[model samples]
Target: MTAAATTHQHTNCLRCGRKLTSTKSTATGYGPTCTRKVKAAAKAEIVATYKPHLVAKAEELIEQGGIVALRGRNVFQVVASNGVDTYKAARQGCTCAAGLKGKHVCYHRIAAHILSLAA
Candidate 1:
């Protein structure tokens, strides 16, 4: 597999809010230093916060395109893995059984968190 970029365009860096005066910076919406920092932070944030299996499940939920935004407050409707049920998920909680347990971290919550970041 491969990925490629042929152009870049942004007026400001997304991370530090700096004016992007150079072409490369504008293209990435990040200055060189911030670009590296953002990548590292993104990779670290998820892994450090959740179990690896849960993270994989959350990513699977996203890849299945079963997430829907609602009410514009970092809330979402996430489909269950069984594909027969849906749950409302927020940053702090979810409606899934595991979420109801209060001691478990549900993938639905992780999916909502991931969606919030992309937003």
Candidate 2:
């Protein structure tokens, strides 16, 4: 993807208050480049922390003959089944870099996360 020649204007780094205007490489619409990495890492950490809990719950629900169907933006489908129980999810949009990569959060991930929590 081609970045605009002029960087999007911002007052200050939302996270660390570092000035991003002076930086050559930056994640648009956000604070400094460093803060972007920090934010992404923090988000990933939180998601990773929650993953085990979510997976365990989902597995338990599946084992108990419960089925769940979730829909999101990307239209991607995921099915999880254990003999009698099955859970399915279909998302409607793409979250990868080709789509809304900078957005970080994708509909497919959100839907699956929601289902995992629901489980």
Q: Which candidate number would show the highest lDDT if scored against the true structure?
A: 1
- Candidate 1 accuracy as lDDT: 0.68
Please give the clash total of every predicted structure, in order.
Answer: 1, 8
TM-score top scorer: 1
Score residue 78 of candidate 1 by CA lDDT. 80
The Cα error of candidate 2 at residue 85, in Å, is 39
lDDT of each: 0.68, 0.37
Q: What is the C-alpha RMSD of each candidate to the true structure, in Å?
A: 8.3, 15.9
Lowest-sum lDDT 10-residue window in model 1: 1-10
Q: Estimate each model's TM-score.
A: 0.63, 0.24
The segments of candidate 2 whose C-alpha lies over 4 angstroms from its true place after superposition are: 1-8, 23-33, 36-40, 51-119
lDDT of 1 at 87: 92
Off by over 4 Å in 1: 1-42
